[model samples]
Structures are given as structure tokens and as C-alpha cells.
Target: MNFDEQINKLIYDWEKHAMPVLRGVAGVNSLAAVALLIYRYGFFLTEEETADLFASFDLIFLIFGMVYLTRLLFQLDRWAFIKSTWLEGVLNLFIIIHGAVNYFFGVKLLLSLSLMFSDANPVLQYQHVLSCYLLLMVMTEVTKLSTHLSNLNIKPATTFIFSFLLLIGIGTSLLMLPASTVGPHSMKTLDALFTAVSASCVTGLAVVDTGQFFTFKGQLVILFLAQVGGIGIVSFATFFATFLSKGVGLKHQSIIQDFLSSEDLSSATQLLRRVIFLTLLIELVGTVGLFFSWSEELVFDSFGQKLFYSLFHSISAFCNAGFSLFPDGLNTSILSDDTTEFAISGMRIDIRRMYGLHMVVAALIIFGSMGFTTIEEVLSPSKIYDRVKKPWKDWRIGTKMALVSTALLLLLGTLAVFILEVDQLRHDKTIVEALITAFFQSVTTRTAGFNTMDFGSMKDSTIIIMMFLMFIGAAPGSTGGGIKCTTFYVLLLSAIGDIRGQKNIIIGRRAISPTVVRKAYSILMFATTYNVFAIFLLSITESGNTDIGILQIAFEQVSAFGTAGISMGITSDLSSWGKVIIIISMYIGRVGTLTLALALSSTVKTNSFRYPEEHVMIG
Candidate 1:
């Protein structure tokens, strides 16, 4: 046979003969008997004696690092390793143990450290904890990216859920541990789960003052949760594998690529490599800029403090999570505080200087807000190389839609907020400063929730503007919330199509698919339905509030649901049920309102043949 034919035959034979053999033994999970034995026997230890158990965790991680290293050296294919003979199956037990113990112990270490938080200083404690979690998160995300970049079949989302669930289990176990005298009061399961969810979700709406509720340990735990949740644990796994191994399997690549998303047929490894690289690039630059920007005022503090602040804000901003160590968030009060203050604190800025910082921060927010798909498409090396070579080359449709929509949204958002706030400039500065703050507020309103002024005092018109910004949200597969710019683009385009009597919505000379149009419309409809429902639920749960107050709550609820964290100073006053509603909204917002819906939507086989066309009544 010819070379191509021979290769195809080889692949066909391998899949036919080899894959099933491996599947029989290595499909999923460890031996049920071994797991049962461990569960049955492993829970007999007391807290006082468990130090050794955790210590073993460190060793197990070291062993995994070594085994994966050895596997790298042998250059054995993932399929070869996964489908090893029965003799090698004996060793697979150790492989499973190594992976499991390392994961278990690593998770426990974080949970234990959180339980030991002292009251000495929450900022200091959380700073340290957030660092550790970021390190771990980056490691895990890298591994995830590496696996996906290398392979196309490994499931990144499933892996992410598994790792997160593992951490939750560890957190639950930690909450059950004996209460420390220095830590905040004991955690009820619901509260602990709530705290964990908030961190993972990266939503800052909390029942307790994250600052004072937990001992330094408790807050640190929360910080770790935020950092982990913010960057995506799968991305951490992807980055970790990158540092250790030279290449990833295609199956692993598929998993990571699926999560990062992209255009055309780019490989997952290339996509993940860029994603991890871009994440670090933005964070490092942001941290350095923040540190230097604040260095003059924060000189009296320890070196660690400045670094932690830089790191915390960098990750938090890029994640598009509106978490702040400050209880009131990035309020005017924080602007005056030396520690957690904005970079502009105490340093008098000329209008020009103010403009520069405004531009810099706005750029960072924009970069952070851009979706993974946007980054992969517009900024990726291959696309960049092609574009450089071919100046007239058209951008990918997603990139075009994202960039155009984001710019328009920001411009419209800025103009609307400025018009509303023109008469309400309550700050001390020239008209330039008012513009700067308004511009920042405009950018922040779309879901970053980083504010320079009080949102509570805004005009009713301003509240409506803020709601629209929050509802439109960031681009598709991005960190921010809303209906997503892509959805917005398609819906608007579809409307335009109807107005023009076109068969399909067209953009940049390309016909937008009906499937895409339908999905976008569905997302918009569901978002509207859900927001109304959230308002109804909140009104019932927190009845007796003013009309304005109700509107504010409704606005914030939708924002949170969109993963847009803008609040009108009412987040702190939410009732328990109200808080739960907000929490659910935040979860849906981050995971995506439509993403959750799609996940819940039934998946079934489709006919290969075309369906007969049918027309329905007009809207």
C-alpha cells in the first residue's frame, strides 16, 4: 500500500484491536475494592495524628512529578502507556495511587492552612494564601492545557469539575475539623460551601465580611479559593505540564483546546501555550506596573505586602472577578487607604498623568475582558504571522465580531455614563478628572466592578445605562459576564436580516448559520426570562425595600448572573435567601447563563438527512 494508505491501515488496526483492550482495564476510576478499603480504613485517624498523613501528601506529589517525568523520558505514546499489557497493569495501580495521593494531599494542605488562619492581619494572611493557590492553580491549569494541547480527546471541563469537586470535598472536611481559637467562628456546611462557591465563582457577594469574618487563616482560605477559581484550575494543570514536559498528547490537547476555545482547526497545544503565556504575560506586566505605581506610598510595608497586592489584583482583574480584600470593594474609602488604595493615592497627578494611568488601567481591563477565543484568534502567533504576511487578510469572524462589538459597547457605555454623570461630578478635580473617573466607571460597569465613585448615588437613568452594560457583558468565552458580545452581534444582525428580508444574517460577506442565530436568540431570551425571574424571587425574599432599592437589587442580581460584579451599595444588605439567589446568579454568570442552559439541554442524535422547511408566525 502507499504510505498514506499504510498509515491509515495502521491507525485503523490500532483502534480496532488495541483501544478496546485498554478500555476494559483503564476506562475510569481505580479498583472499587481498593477505594472501598481505603475509605473504610482511612477515616480512623484523629486530627492530632494526621500531620504525617499530610506530610505523605508532599512525597506523593514528588513521586508523581517523577513518574510523569520518567514517562516523558521513555517517549512512550499516551495510548501505549494507557493501553499497556496486563503485566504493566500491575504498575498502573501505582500510577493511579501516585496521581490520587498527590491530588488529595495537595488539596488538604490548602484546606488545612485555611483552617489555621490567625487574626494577626487578614491582608497578610490572604496574600500568602492567594500566592500558594495561584502557584497550584497555575500548575494545574498548565497540566490541563498541556494535556489538551497534546491530545484532542481528554475532557478539560470534566477534569476541571473533578478537581474543583475534590477541593470542595477537602474544604468540607476542613470545616469539620476542630475550630481554632484564633480563626473566625466555626463554619456551618452551608456557609463553608457558600464560601467555597463564592471563591470558585469569583463573586465577592458574601454573607460575612471576608476581611473580618475569617481569621487570617479563614480569609486566606477564601483568597486561595478566589485565586484558584479565578484562573481556572484546568489552566493551572496545563501550565504545570508545560514547565515539565516538552509536548502533550493530542487527546490532552483536545481537552484543553475545548476549554480555551478557538477558530478554524488550530491545535489545542498551540492554543494553550498561547493562553498560559498570555495569562502570565498580562499578570506579570500588571503586577510590575501596580507594584511600581504604588511603591512610593507602600515603601514602609514589607516587600511581600506590595508583591501580594500586585498579584492579588492582577489575578482578580484578569479573571474579571470583582473580589476585593476591602470589604466595601474598590470604594472611595479604599482610595484614601495607603495599603489597598488605588495607585493614584497620595500622588498628585497632572491631568496628563491621570490620563496615562486611566489609559493603562483601561487597557488592562480591556485585555482581561477579551475572551479566550478572541485572544487565540486575534493575538495568536500563527494568525498574527499570517496577518503580518497578508495585510489585507480578513480577520476571523469571531475576532471581527468580538473586537467591533467590544469597542462599540465600551464607547456607548462611556458616552451613556458620562451623559448621566455630567451633572453629578462629586469628585474634586478638573473636568478632566471627572472624565477620567467617568471613563473608568464606563469600562468597569460592564462587569469588572472596579469603581472610582459611589454607584449608589447614581441617577435612575445611570442605573439603566449600567444595567444595559452589564446585560451586554464581555465577549464570548471571555472572563466577563452578560449575554456575550457574540450573542449581541448575532441577535442584532438577525434583527437586521429580518428588517432587510434576508434569508440569513450576513457579516463580513459570510452567512451566519441558523444554528448560531438560534442559539444567540435563545441566550438573549433566557437571560431576559431569568433576570425577570431573579427580580421576582428577590422581591419576595427581600420585600419591604424601596422601588429604587428593588431596581438596584434587580440590577445587581442580573450583573452577578452575567458575572458582572457591579453593585449599587446594596450587596451587603441582601437577606440569606437573597444572597443565595445572588450566588446562583453569579454561578450562572461565570459558567455562563446560556452555557448552563446548554449543559442542561438534552443532547440527542440528529438525522443525517435534511428536514423539510416550515414557516412559523412572525414575532
Candidate 2:
């Protein structure tokens, strides 16, 4: 045989014989990586044990390098293969270079870089890099595994619900580890589960003080959960699979379309990519903005701490997950005191206000709550270009509806809060400061869960207004949760149509579909029913506590159901059963009421024979 023919035969033989083994090995390695990471971060290891862990990590990297090299060697179109797996290729190349340098020169490249950039311990920084690399590897494996989920014959809604449950499970386990808490002992199971649900659902409610009770490692776990939960597990899995693989299968795309609320299955993958990119892009910009916006008075132990705070709050705000590093949330006295006392328009305003930081966080919250689809339509480069080319182009009806509803809610909530608390607000702060605080509260109450003023101190009327806002919550398909603004808007439109004696509900010159209107009402009814049941449960569970009233119980129930996370100083004092009830409420809220109903209810096809339609009694 010719030399070329011989090489081809050998390559084909290697692929035929070794590829399956390699795939199995890769799966094992991914699982090993996850285990190693859990051990490395989740425990307090002795010096010798730490050394052994690092050694194990290096060995894993070496195996990964060998596997990549073997695959590269057998590929006929090496360039195409490398391009398809560029991210993995780059990581593998870095691992190889780091390994070579450590072996040949007895110097760790990551440690050296850590020393150059940070004042923290070099070894610890090096471990962080390795942990991050392992995390990436784990996520890649997860995405690969997710592609096989279609074979399980589960509905897309069921898959979506299961994804969050899986995330919460993993997060709970991680948070319960010894190293995750400030105390020597691990977090209690209930607290860990509650925190995990809050983070995974992006609800931001916490039984423990996030800033004081958890170590930095624990906070990191929460951050990861919030980010993944914000974008959604399905989106992460599908995006990674599509980005790394040659292409996504039809099944993956079909599932992704439901998650993204995309009508066109062909563009589901593209929308997923855009959503992820936009999310990260917004977060990065927010981080930079927050870093600069922090008042000089607010001190950190180190630059890394400062950076982490910025990054954490940025993700939390953008996710509408109000997990804060501050003990008292945004209303922490320290944060308010950190701001400068300034004057505006000849009015001497001596009161301190978190103007810059609050505004930045509010903006992030607003953007996140607007939904990815709306964000894409408004901010995407292609859309901008199209709009520029065609000035007459209008936003989709959904976008218009979301925008209008959000604006109305924000305006109404702001005015209501301002009016209700005007005397109390003006007693302690200037008009401008009061206005800013009112605005921030309005922006956060819907879904962000941030508080500039103490909820316990607010008037009952103001609390009612906040609850109304929370009930409506954010836009559909957004990170934040509630019945959703679209649902709220649709119901309002339907009400208006009925009042006007019209057969159809119209908005933006387009008739709303009956199916959509029905779904909207279904969500509302489901949400109301759940909230009522949850409030009753909470009332029964906490009946022994004299400090807790029905108003507080009801407020807590609605907050959990809306995933708003605000509470009247009651989260930490809840009984175990109360926490469990809240946990269920958060889960139902995060996965929409309608989505859970769909997931639980089986489809029943009707016979071809028609039956007479019946009218329902009026409310």
C-alpha cells in the first residue's frame, strides 16, 4: 500500500477501535474532576492533603491533554476539529504549557501570575484557577449529558423543572460542606436547602445572614447558582453543546425553543447564544460600573475582596436575585453612610444616599426583568442595524406590552411609595434623597428584592403597594419571577375589553389570542390559589409565635410566591415547616404557575365529535 493509504487505514482503525474507549474515559474524568473539586473546596484539608489534591489535579490535566492530543491526531480535518472545539483546545493547550513549565522549571505559572497580580497567598490563588478549570470541564460534561435527556421521553417543561431541582440539590450539598460556613460545623440541612432554593430560584430570600454566616467559598457557591439559575440550566446546557459540538440536534433545539420562548425553532440556538452573550456582557459592564461606583468610605480587606463584591452584586442585581454581601441588604447603614453629602439646585441635602450604586443596580435589575427576548429585540446589533435602515420598524407587540407594563408599574409604585411614606421619608432625608430611595424601592420591589428602607418600618399601605408590584413581577421569560408582566397586562386588557362590551382584547392594534388570554388567566388563578394555600399553611405553622401577625404571614407568602425575597424581618424566625412552605412557594414562583401546571398535568386529546360550548358564570 502507498504511504498515504497506509496512514489513512491506521487512522481509521484507531478511530474505530479507540474512540469509544476514549469517550468513556472522558466521562470518568469529568466525574473525577467534579469529585476532586468538591473535596478541594468543600473541606478543610491539612497541608499534606492539600498537596495530594493538587497532585491529583495535575494528573487529571495531563490525562485531558493526552485525550485531546489523541483525538487531534486521528482527525482527518484537524483544522475543522480544532475550530469546532476551540475553547477546549485552548484550555488543553494552557494545561500542557503549565504542566511543562512546572515539571521542567519547577515553577508554577499560575502561582507566579497570582503573586504578580494579588497580595493573597499564591497557593490559594493557584487552587482557584485549577478549580475554575475543573468547573468549566464539569459544565462541558453536563452540557454533553443534557443532549441525551431527550431520549428519556420527558416533556420539555418537566426537563426545565428538573434542571432547577438538580441545581438546587447540588447547591444545597455544596453549601452544607464544612468549608462553606464561617463556623467549624457545616450549615444545617434545612438552611442549606432553603438557601440553595433561594439562590437557584434567584429568589434572594435567606434565613441566615449571607454576609456573616457564610464563608467566601459559600458565597461563591451562591453566586454560581444565581448565575446559572438566572440564565437557566437548559440555556447553559444547550449553549455549551451547540457552541462546542458540530451542531445541536433537532431535539435540543426543540427543547430550547420552549425555554427561550422562541417561535422559530431554527433560531433557538442563535437566540440561546445571544441571550448568554448579552447576559455576560451586561454583567461585565455592571461589574465595572459597580467597582467604580463604590464609595471610598466602604472598605474591603483587599482588592480581591472589592472585586468579588462588585462581581457578586452585579450578578445578583442582573439576576434580580437580591443576595447581598451586606448584612442589612442595600439598606445597610454602612452603605448609606458611605455616600457623599451633596446639594442639588440650591437645596442643601445633608443626607447620604447610595446614588451611583443604587442607580446602577436599579438599571441592572430593570434590564434583567425585561426578559432576554425583549432585550435582544431592543439591544441586538442586527436589530439596531435593521431599525436604522428602516425607521418605520416597530417593536413586536409583546415587547411593546412588556415595556408599557413595566413603565406603568414602576411609575405607579414609585408614586404610591412616595405618597404613602412622604412624611417619614422627608423627616430623615432631603426631597431628592427621598425621591431616589422611592425610585429604588419601586425598581426592586417588583422582583429584585433590594431594600433601601426597612420594610418593617414602612406603613401598611406602602407594604400593600409593594405586594401589588411583587405580584405582577417581571416580564415573561425573564430571570425574575411572578405571574409576569405580560400575564398581568393581558388580564388587564381582557378586563378592559369585557368592560367595554367587546369580544376581543386588543393592544398595539393587534388582537390577543384567546389561547394566550386563557393561559394568562390560568397563571393568575394558579398564583392566587397557591398564595392563599401557602399563607394558610404559614399561619398554621407559625401560630405559636405572638410576634407574627396575619399581615406579615400573608406578605411573606406573596413574597415567596412572587420570588420577590423581601420579608418583614421574619425569614430567620420561621419554623421548619414554615421554611418548607416558603421553599415550595419559591419553586412554584420561579417555575411559573402555568409551567408547573403544564408539567404536572397530562395531555388529554379530545375525540373528533364536537360538543356544545357552555358559558361560565360571571365573577
Candidate 3:
């Protein structure tokens, strides 16, 4: 056989023979992983306690890491790990180093190594290294499991739903742990589940003040959930797996292409790589900006605390989760004393009163909500200069639609909100603050949930405006969730076409697909129906119990259905049944209304046979 044939044969042989053994190994590692995870997150363990607990089964991670490392070293014929990119190889190398140090040098070297990361807390370094090792093991096993699942011929959509359900379930369980909560009382299971759902759905709606009620471990759990859920669990797992093995298989690429809504399977791997890289890049930059914004605030207890605050908010913002470390979300100006104030340029400002911070956050939200495809079209490395110089040349219709719709929505939303709330804003704030807040509110209303002004205090007209904006949310395939700007845009074009007595809906001289328009209508109708149903349920469940009005209840339900999370200060007081309704709304909204609709549908029946069509009056 030639080189290609030989390589193919080798892969087949490995899969036919070696995979069984690897599967068994992965099964064992999964059990060990469970124990390790519990030990790490189940309780507040001291440095010595953590060390002792790790010592109990310390060899498990080491052995798995070494095995993968060996696969990289001696398996040149297999071209497994080495075939992965250099960055992945470097990461695996660190895993091997960690495993070696743990096996050979044990606690002594780990202590010395801990100094490299944190002098005051070497145990954190140890924990970080162990977490890395565990991650490597999990990724390998998960990759294998996914392959096996694909072999069993599971549908990608079904797998996607299951993966999210699994993440939410696990996150809920972890957040319910006693150590995850602060103070005397533990977090109720229902509340924990709600928070877990919100975080995993990247909805940012919470029953408790995240900074106050959730311990560091809990915050970390939420942060982890947001990241995984923002990108999607399957994409997140497979992206890391691609680094440890050969390129992603065609089947895997097909599934990921569907998940990301990419052009095709051919670009799925490259798209995933860019997605992960872009997410991290944007979050890192946001963190730096936030760090400077908060550095002058001096509210954090330590530099590490401030750094974590910045990092958490950055990730949360970019993920469009709307989670804030501040107790009142971003409305910290009213909640905290002047000590938390910061100097921007020359003027002193409260954390909540910082217009510059709001602008930075608004930028993150806009970029995040634009969707990766639109981002790639405009800002990808190859297109960056072309976009600036040529400006709209070669842009896709979707890109143009997204940009135009976003701008139009932002302008109108800002103008509407500013005009409606001018009296309220002008009472205490300057014109600049009022304008910035209006812009910020407009940017956030479409999806990102961070609120500078309290929604509870806003007028009903403003709330109605916000509800409308939230209903038509961020663009498709973005971290932000809703019916999607494209879906709404298509519906609008269809309406306009009907008014003009046109059959084919056209934009920019390009005819829109009939199928696409139909799908958009279906999505819009389904979303509206879902929101109405959810609102009815919440109204019945929370009526008379809450001090708030029906409008507020409807607002909250729409927010949940939109995955917007901009509540009118009634989320915490929601009845259990109401919470359940919101939870379902959040889940369906994040998963896509049509995705749930499809999953529930009997099957995709081909319309080979049809009865004679009869025109029916409508509108």
C-alpha cells in the first residue's frame, strides 16, 4: 500500500483493536475524575487536606496523562498527539510535566512549583496543575465517548440537547453543594437549579446576588458553565480534543458546522479554532479594560480579588451571560459607599456611575451579539484591511443585514429610551450620563442583560420598549440568545414585500430564499406563542404573591424567553412554579425555539404526495 493507504489501514486497525482498550481506560478515568471533582468542589478543603485527598488517587491522573504523552512520543505511525497543532502539543507537554512532577517529586516539587504561580498560596498552583491534568483526561475520554456515540448513529441535534441538559444537570448538582454557597444557610436546591440553568444557558438571570450568595467555588462553577454553554459543550469538548488527536473527523465537523451555523463542514474546524481564539482574545482585552476601570475603584480586598473580578466580568460580558459580581448587578453606585469610587481621566466616579465602563461593556455586548460569522466576515485577519479600505465589498447578505439591523435597532432603541426616560435620568444625572445610559440600555436590551439603571424604576412605556427589543434579540449563532436579528429581519422584509404586492422577498438585489422566509415566520410565531404561554403561566403562578404588577411579570417572562435576563427586580421573589416556567423558557430560548419544535416533531416527512391546495383568507 502507498503512504495514504497505509495510514488509513493503520487508523482502521487502531480503531478496531486499540479503541476498546482505550475505552476501558477512559471508563476508569471517568470514575476517578468524579471522585477528584467531588473532593475539589464538594467541600472547603485546606491545603493539607487537598494534598491528602489528591494523594488518595494521585496516580490516576498521572497515569492517564502519561499514557497520552506516550501516545504522542512512540505512536509516530498513529500520528495521534503529534499530529495535533503545536499549541496543543505544548499544553499536553505541560500535562506530562505535571504528571511527572506529581509521580516523581510529589508534594515537595509541587510546593516549589506553586511559588511560580502564587507565593502566598502554592496550593492553588497545585490545584491548577491537577485541574489541567484532569481536564486532559476528561477531554480524551469525552472524545472517545463522542466517537462511540456517533458510531451508534445519534442525531447531532439530539446530542446537542443532551449535552446541554447534562451540563445544566451537573452544574446544578455542583452549585447545590454546601461549600458552593456562603453564610449560614445553604442554597436551596430549587434556587441552585435555577441559577445553574441560568448560568449554563448564559441567561444571567439569578435568584440571588451572585457576589454575595455564591462562594468563590460557586462563582467559578457558574463561570465555567457560562463559558461551556456560551460556545456549546460539544464544540468546546471537540475543539480541545482536536488538539490531542488528528484533525476532527468529517462526521464531527458536520455536527460542529451545524452547531456554529458555518458555511460548510470544510470550514468547521477552522471556524471552531477561530471561535475559541476570538472568544478568549475578546475576553482578555475586556478584562484588561475592566481591570483599569476597577483599579482606581479600590473596592476589592486584594489584587487577586480585583483580577478575578475583572476576569469573571470580562468572560461573562463576552459570553453575553450578563452576570455581574456586584450585588445589584452593575448598579453598584446606589448600593455601595463612595469608597468604591474610581477616578477616570480626572473625575472621580462610582463603579456603577462610570460612563466609560458602561461604554466598554456596551462595546463587548455589541461585538458579542454580532455573531461569529458576521465578525469573521468583517474582522477576520484576511478581511480586516479589505473591510476598512473597501468597506462593504464582498460582504455577505447576512453580514449586511446584521450590521444594518443592529445599527437601526440601536439608534431607534436609544432614541426611544432616551426620550421616554429623559425626565428620570435628568433628575439626578447629567445629559452625558443620560445619553450614555440610554445607549448602554439600548445595546443591552437586545440580549446582553447588564443594566446600569434599575428596570424596576423605569416607566411602563420604557419597559414595553425594552420588552420589544428583548423579544427581537441578538443575531443568529451568537452567544446572545433570542429569535435572532436575522429571523426578525426576514419577517420584516416579508411583511414589506406583501405590502408592495411582491411574491419574492428581495434585499440588496439578492432574492431571499423562500425556505428561509418560511423558517423565519415559523420561528417568529413559535417564539411569540412560547412567550405568551410562558407569560400566562408566570402570571397565574406569581399573581397576588408578588407586589409587582402583571406588566412586570410579563416583562420577566419575556426576558426569560428572550434569554435577556433584564428583570424588573422581581426574579428573586419568583414563586417556585414561576421559576420553573422561567427555567423552561430560558432553556428553550437558549436551545432555539425551533430546535425544540423540531425535536418534538414526529419526523421530517417528505411531501411527496399533497392534496389540492385551497386558498384560505388571512390577515
lDDT of each: 0.61, 0.86, 0.79
lDDT, candidate 1, 543-582, per-residue tens: 8656436778777787777676777777757777877788
lDDT of 1 at 549: 64
Q: Candidate 1: what lDDT?
A: 0.61
| Cα lDDT tens digits for candidate 3, 109-207 | 555767776867676766777666566656666665665445655566677777889999999988888788886666788998899889988888989
Kindly indicate the candidate among 2 and 3 with the higher TM-score. Answer: 2
Clashes of each: 44, 0, 0
Query: For candidate 1, what is the total of clashing residue pairs?
Result: 44
Q: What is the TM-score of each candidate against the true structure?
A: 0.71, 0.90, 0.89
Better of 1 and 3 by lDDT: 3
Model 2: which ten-residue window has the lowest total lDDT? 342-351
TM-score of 1: 0.71
Query: Which residue window of length 10 is worst by lDDT in model 1?
Result: 26-35
lDDT of candidate 2 over 1-619, digit per residue (tens): 9998899888988897787787788889988988998898889899899889888988788888898899898998899999988888888999899899999999888889888998968778878887888788767666767778767877778888888999999999999999999877999999999999999999989998897788888999999999999888878888888877777767678767876678799999898899889899999999999999887655555788789989999999999988988777887764323322211223322213668888999999999999889999998999999999999999999899889999999999889989999987899788888888899889987688788888898999998889889999999878889999989899988898888999998887898899999998888888898898888889999999999999899888888888888989999999999999999999999988888888899898976898899999977
True-vs-predicted CA distance for residue 324, candidate 2, Å: 0.9
Local distance difference test, candidate 3? 0.79
Point out where model 2 deviates above 4 Å.
1-21, 69-80, 93-124, 334-352, 614-616
lDDT of 2 at 123: 78
**Candidate 2 structure lDDT:** 0.86
